[model samples]
Target: MYFTPALLAAVATVIGLATATPVPEPQGIAAGSIELCTGQYLQGRCTTITTPTGTCVEFPRGFHNDVSSVSGLEGWNCNLYHDDHCTSASYYVQGEQDTLPTDNFNSVICTPPP
Candidate 1:
């Protein structure tokens, strides 16, 4: 077997990346949601976003507001729904925010890019 310096470097790089945990860096709302936020929201701040693996979730204040605005920071895209279990999904938007019918969304589902 022959070992090239370039090949060795490439292998090391791949190994490093594969072992890295994404829980530290910010992956925006969706990945953030998946990693820790859901449980927090469900259990009342189970973790704080300041923690390396923690995240935050926020919702708007009362009546005069609608979820008329949504954002998919860092290419995040999701289907906002007025009902649970992802019924009636909103259109997909990326690298920018999405808007929904005023204050209507109650649940959301994330979809990978095609």
Candidate 2:
């Protein structure tokens, strides 16, 4: 069978639509990532943490008790702790936390949303 240009274009459109994936809400931020900032309202020095497989991460030395803002938790749930290894005091956070409940957290464990 001979295929015309219009027919090919139509087929491509259909294929593209069929294979397209729905974009989750709050685009840009990935499913398992969080941003930590030293100032409130997401200002000042900032760093991003990615835990695609749900892992515990410790804040670098001097960063402990210095994170006043947190963001990029669109599809993730993270537990902030006041001690290393995700121990001691903990605060649960999800979504953009422009001003963290507490800025003394020293460790975090981030997991993708269920």
Candidate 3:
């Protein structure tokens, strides 16, 4: 293959742009119970979700650590901005029952676990 300086520069620019892209942050909290949503087994149950606008919402402790997986909640809808920045979001309860308040509210406010 013939290697051209311009082609190489173009490829470099493309790679740079892709790497420079930022991920969306969480914007709101999603409510749900274990019975309601079911699927892959989570390490620590997702007690609550913190949605911080223009930034990634850090999971409490357990649950999916990766933003991509967490964002993939079936009922949960994510409004991602630049990269993975979450502008608006909501969680849909799969099962039925009373809405229990999240226990780790402080975790979301004080120190959001990465």
Candidate 4:
């Protein structure tokens, strides 16, 4: 195929746009009960709980009152639950700091309630 400069530019533009677009962030954890185990000053803490839908929740940095505590830690140990039932759980540290616990740490894959 004979490629023209304009055609190449158009292709490049399309590729750039496709890659640059960011993925939409998941919606924050739904309404559910959280069991958190946090230490004073946000140190030496571990959290484990079950979401209302059996999503298997975990507490990285042990559930921080704010985002700063888990800002640095990533891939800590934690468990998840949904609807008061144990589903899939794993250990993961904090990925980013956010007011919401779910937003602060990267949640491991877990089996949601059937």
RMSD of each: 13.2, 7.6, 15.9, 13.1
TM-score of 3: 0.22
Per-residue lDDT of candidate 3, residues 41-60 (tens digit): 32223343544322354443
True-structure lDDT of candidate 2: 0.80
Q: Tell me how many clashing residue pairs each candidate has.
A: 2, 0, 16, 18
| Residue 76 in model 2: lDDT | 74
- On residues 16-94, what C-alpha lDDT tens digit does candidate 1 reach at each position? 9889585767666334222112221123222222111122223322312234454443444455556544445454444
Model 4 C-alpha lDDT per residue in residues 1-114, reported as the tens digit of each score: 899999999999999888866789998754333334343334445444444332444445434332222332233333322222234343333333233334233343332232
- Give TM-scores for every candidate, taking all chains together and pairing residue i with residue i: 0.37, 0.67, 0.22, 0.24
The number of residue pairs in model 1 that clash at the backbone is 2
Query: How does candidate 4 score on lDDT?
Result: 0.40
Index of the highest-TM-score prediction: 2
For 6-114, candidate 2 gives per-residue lDDT tens digits of 9999999999989969786775434477788899998998888775545678887667899998875677788888988776878988888888877888888887767
lDDT of model number 1: 0.42
Clashes of 2: 0
Ranking by TM-score: 2, 1, 4, 3
The pairs that clash in candidate 2 are none
Model 2 poorest 10 in a row by lDDT: 24-33
Model 3 local distance difference test score: 0.34
Q: Tell how far residue 88 is off in model 3, in angstroms.
A: 33
Models ranked on lDDT = 2, 1, 4, 3
Of candidate 3, the 10-residue stretch with the lowest lDDT total is 102-111
